[model samples]
Target: MKVSCLIFFLFFSLFAVAQTTPTPKKKLVVVNSYTQYRAAIKSNPNNELVEIKKAIPGISLDIRYATKNNFMQQVMYKQARAFARKPVVESLKKIQKELNKKGYGLKIFDGYRPYAITVEFYKKASDKNFVANPAKGSKHNRGCAVDLTLINLKTGKELEMPTPYDSFSAAAAAKYEKVSPEAKKNRNFLISIMAKYRMNVLENEWWHYDFADWKNYDLMDIPFEKL
Candidate 1:
């Protein structure tokens, strides 16, 4: 009986240690060095981050994160410029041309955000659901995502959507149905046009879209000044 009790305690102690052991965290690789980015572009020119405005002239830029108008209520980027992968900019150029024919134009809010900014957003955002977790990084950090809205070219006024940019509500959803008929029509039209250019709208945010081949790019931490 004494021997059996001692063996049981030893088995219980081993089980407790195994249960308390923590798993190792996964390591994330973020490209922060300009030299590294240059090397990547040298290997594949498609990896180059092209300035959207320069690539597609006449594209309007709001760049809210450069001002204090964003959800953070603080300036995140020093410059009000936006950029994306070479192919991404090309796709936008085509989308812009098509929209222009319809008297509409693309107004960009943000693009190619540094990975560090994403970490800041995850930490500061009150509604965590809308923000991307830093552990997985964001498509914007990969320079393959864009935040934008449609605007009437003649009036330069934004089209009425279900909700304003960065709204943390169910109405912000790309297909939310409880909105006005005009909003639904405008939102669906924007989504369809963006889809035609390989930009898929985010399920939660109608204004957010990820390039179809975003996974091909690496998460970047390079600042706007470097690019």
Candidate 2:
């Protein structure tokens, strides 16, 4: 009887140890093409969050409403609440100051997109031939990407960029040679500020740039209302 009791306790002890051991977390499945995701504001109207230029010094947006017909957006506009990402917003303020000295204003087209908005963008990217995949995690999904450009605040007009935001054609290319010098100057101002701040531009789009520290952020889906 004593031997049996001892053996039962030992078995119980082993079972408890096994139960205490934690199971490993599963690896997340990564999507294929979040790299090239941009949406037109028309399809994803979530870009209409209240603009807060003063929140970040030197930062201003030639917001669609701010400038009637001169607004620009991505083909896959994932509604990011960049206002929610204050650090990024603040960075834009610094960037705004840098560009202001050169007679330019940082007109943000998009920022801090909501997760549901990103999912919407993913669906748009799923359309073959016209767009690519947003299934992979997007830099925008990370809430560290910005769709923006330098605007001539004085003219109340958007500066000449190589291509309009989300242009799928060759005109969107950073080095599209046929672009005008004024456009190049505008593009250079954006590039210089971004480079100084360690931001990287998307190859096909002129107004897109992802912060270098993007990997540090988790994919966010927080909505504009929530922000």
Candidate 3:
């Protein structure tokens, strides 16, 4: 009878432990976003991409940024990635889902850039005294702007567009390449998807889009890990 009681106590203790100890949390893994663009060797090493499966629980890294042109593989503002807030990530995921249904994906150019990176960009812009107004507000800083084009997932090829991203010339004009049927189709398609979300093009740069409510977001420098 004493032996039976001992076994029963042991069983109850085990059950209590199972009930009290917390389950192991699902882990999220992500590579730093700026690490690749800063290298800019022209070889887009895919290792740096944020994996959705390893990121937030129940959320997968949406691979909308992958493109085909090989030439369109431009990375921008290494320090600018806005993983600081959950709303920002959710917004991008939603856009990814919508674009996927349209047979295209969002090719990310830049996101969540540090203010210091913006300082570097501003200096090069020949204006703003090398200090971003902190008011004009870069899209990446606001976690809303993304430089991308229509990418066909099946072929893993970016649809022909007006010009390469971040090209500082007339070639970058949205309607400049009107002669190429493929370019026009690609350009129009990009604009259409952005419009659905009330996003607007940067005008000079065809590939850049900014969400209309950008003012609501504050400039943040949260590291990618904290996201």
Candidate 4:
């Protein structure tokens, strides 16, 4: 009968539509297991994460995530330590030497963040623009980004920058022009020196820098304790 034929066609069409619907694709690949991380380093020594302070002695650390001073206003990291990929730390060593000679030193606020922490930041951040989405892991999770500032070698006082570290305001923009001459000069100087060592500043954060070869690294979720 015509009625039976119509019902069968409708059922067929619905089945076709269901079959053609695509499954959502995973947007990120994170190395979450220590065994996996160890395998990665074994395959490529460059993947090894190096502790920054041990590699560059005298490097200052004010790890905010380990305290309640960061934008989250909650302690996110258990340890106040910083690490980066082998080559990244090497570049920091060179940058530190260069800055130290000029009566300045690098003060690290963060480096090589765990991917899970980045996800937590995205979930809790009031200003989403300032936080990396969990769908796309952060460069810091790849052990190829650093959050830092310049400090006077003698006084250990941080230099005047356009905005403080992890500032979610417009003034934190790397190229924001509406700042004091001293702030602008110091900001640009920091950018230039970091560039010379293959570390480029993030457009929206004056203190955040991504190593040039970041794409070569894998997003990681290993904790500082494991490293």
Q: Using lDDT, give the best candidate's number.
A: 1
- The sequence of per-residue lDDT tens digits that candidate 3 reaches over residues 54-91 is 33332222222233322324343233332312344455
How well does model 4 score by local distance difference test?
Answer: 0.95
Rank ordering of all candidates by TM-score, starting from the highest:
1, 4, 2, 3
Q: Please, what is the whole-model Cα lDDT of each candidate in the order they appear?
A: 0.95, 0.60, 0.54, 0.95
* Candidate 2 residue-wise lDDT, 1-227, digit = tens: 99999999999999999999999866544322222122322344333223345476445554331232322234333232234244455567677777777777876766665555555545655333323244555666556778887777677577788877666667776667788888887787677788677677777777888777677555655444443
Candidate 3 worst ten-residue window by lDDT: 58-67
Q: Write the per-residue lDDT of candidate 1 for residues 20-139, one digit (tens) a residue.
A: 999888898899999999999999999999999998888999999999998999999999999999999999999999999999999999989999999999999999999999999999
The residue ranges of model 2 lying beyond 4 angstroms of the native Cα positions read 1-54, 62-84, 125-132
C-alpha TM-score for every candidate = 0.89, 0.65, 0.57, 0.89
RMSD in order of candidates: 3.6, 11.2, 17.9, 4.6
For model 4, give the RMSD to the true fold.
4.6
What's the number of clashes in each of the models? 0, 15, 13, 0
Candidate 1 global Cα RMSD: 3.6
Report the Cα lDDT for candidate 3.
0.54
Query: What's model 1's TM-score?
Result: 0.89
Q: Clashing residue pairs in candidate 1, if any?
A: none
